[model samples]
Target: MIVTELRFENYRNLKNNTIVPAENVNVIYGENAQGKTNLIEAIWLFCGGHSFRGSKENEMIAFDNKYFRLGMNFFSGGREQSADIAFGQNRKQIWINGVERSSSSYLTEVFSAVVFSPEHLNLIKRGPNIRRRFIDAAICQHRIRYASLLSKYQQIINQRNALLKDIRKHSELKDTLAIWDDSLITVGAMIMKERYDYLKMLREPAKTYHHGISAEKETLDIEYQSTTKTDENDDFGTLTGKLRAAFDASQREDFYTGYTSVGPHRDDLDFKINGISVRRFGSQGQQRSTVLSLKLSEAELLYQKNEERPVILLDDVLSELDNSRQDFLLNKVEAYQVFVTCCEESNKVQLKNGKVFYIENGVVK
Candidate 1:
């Protein structure tokens, strides 16, 4: 996927602006708080229409401004497409090709963007939720059905929890608990299957990239840490049945805890380097290298599945790497569209064919 044009108005500190980026690599440099990362975020948000920085809608509006708007024209499916977004304090609207659409229709067969930021360097050491989110966000882009199932599963869990809370005061509500359990088990099983399939496809590439970055000294291993053991040869029916049984076994405990106790919501991704848990055993460099490998692996996996290299947004990531590692990263993504944010022109990683833009107080020059 390639973005042919991008423009923003009243977004963050940036004024009405347009960015013309080279298809290969675009390097953006500025001093601290000059809106370098904000520019990167605009591209990511417009491409996928989701916030990678986890900012809310109103927070993205410029100070003293009424609203924010972004326009993105991209090339996908051997043709061009566009998305326009407008957001205010309490409302947001999205349009695809001038046709009003909801944000729910995104990432099905639409645009894909892979991002790497400094905060992700702690993926291995952070709580399990971060790692699970990493897998969910990446997989959801490639398979829209997985996203639907995830949403339904979350809803089922919420309903089940609410029922549990009511059951404490009125024991009569306990009889209908099986209805939610069945739905949760079915959807949760599919979610687990998809996550397992994705990680299974991702493990080899992540290890290869990890070995390249670690100089063959570290081996990356990934696995699913679910609430219950998964069967290898079971079909969907059998898997659902097994999960349902597990839920039934945990029902009393869940009722006591006032929530659904066993499902993918509690699942995690287990990472190890050379048979040792990276969370406790890996050094700082090792953790960063592992996260980098996984992210690059995500880009490669998307390309393999979609037949289009995703637009990569690097948010002030190179500053944390050495010269060799920086060069290696640039070399790895040279063939795809990339946008890198940095603090200085001298600190930029030189590329064979890349455009450089300067930013000052949110204006691109």
Candidate 2:
């Protein structure tokens, strides 16, 4: 998918601006905090119905402004389409092809975007929640039902944790805990099963991409870490039984800690390089390569599942990589539409066909 044009009003530091982006590679260059990232953020929000930076709709509006508006024209699957998203302190709406609609209804219909930022380097070394979020977000884009399942699983976990906490003060509530346990096992088991299936599909692509980027010297392996041990080929019935048994064993400890301990929420993804844990043993370059491989793998997976490639969003990430790595990234994304930001044109790696937009003081020139 390619974005033909974009218009923004009262968005971040940009008051009112419009530009037509190149289909292949569109480059935005400016100094720090000069609206380069804000432009890309607007495109990402249009694609995903939310901010890649985790900002709320109101937070994305311009300073002292009451509302913000962003509209984009896109070409995909040999057809032209347009979408607009508007939001204010109290209201938000989305329009597709000139028809007003709910944001969630058609959010994923226009396009898919994979964002790379310097902060993503933490995927391997940071806490487990970040890694889990990465997987969940990718899965939700391709499998819409996964989002509802995830929400239900989280609700059940919250209820189960509350019940565990109450059990400490009143032993009588312990019997009522069985109801929450049943709910947790049902929803949590489905979540775990879906995650396991997704991970299985992710392994081969991720390993191949990692090897290509690392020149075959380093081997990357990803393992899904669950609270209960189960074979890779185990069905949901067996896995659910194991999860129930594990939860039963951990009930007392969970009550003491005031949290449900054994479920998908507590699970993690493990990355290893050449038989060593990437988080503890890999160098900085290795960690960066691992993250890049994972993202590229995601793009490939999306393309394989859907015939069209996902759009690429590079948020000042190329500036942090060496020229060799930058070249690899640029070459890999040659076929898809890419939006990249940098401090200046000279800092960007050379590309065959790209349009450069100079951003200065919140204006695109």
lDDT computed for candidate 1: 0.81
How far in Å is the alpha carbon of 320 misplaced in model 2? 3.3
Candidate 1 has which clashing residue pairs, if any?
Answer: none
What are the per-residue Cα lDDT tens digits for candidate 1 across 1-365? Answer: 88888899999988688887888888888999999888888888766556777898899999998899999888888988988888986888888888887663563457777888888875787788888888998888778787788888888889989999999999998889888887888888888878878888899999998887766778999867778666544678877887887788888898899987777898887788998888888777677777888887898998998898888888877665666667766666556898888887745556667788899998898
TM-score of 1: 0.82
Report the C-alpha displacement of residue 351, candidate 2, in angstroms: 1.9
- Model 2 per-residue lDDT tens digits across residues 246-276: 8899988898999988788988898998888
Error of 2 at 195 (Å): 0.7
lDDT for predicted candidate 2 compared with the true structure: 0.82
Model 2 off-target regions past 4 Å?
A: 63-67, 88-90, 102-104, 169-179, 346-348
In angstroms, give how far residue 113 of model 1 lies from its true place.
Answer: 1.2
Q: How much lDDT does each candidate structure score?
A: 0.81, 0.82
- TM-score of each model, in listed order: 0.82, 0.88
Alpha carbon deviation, residue 1, candidate 2 (Å)? 0.9
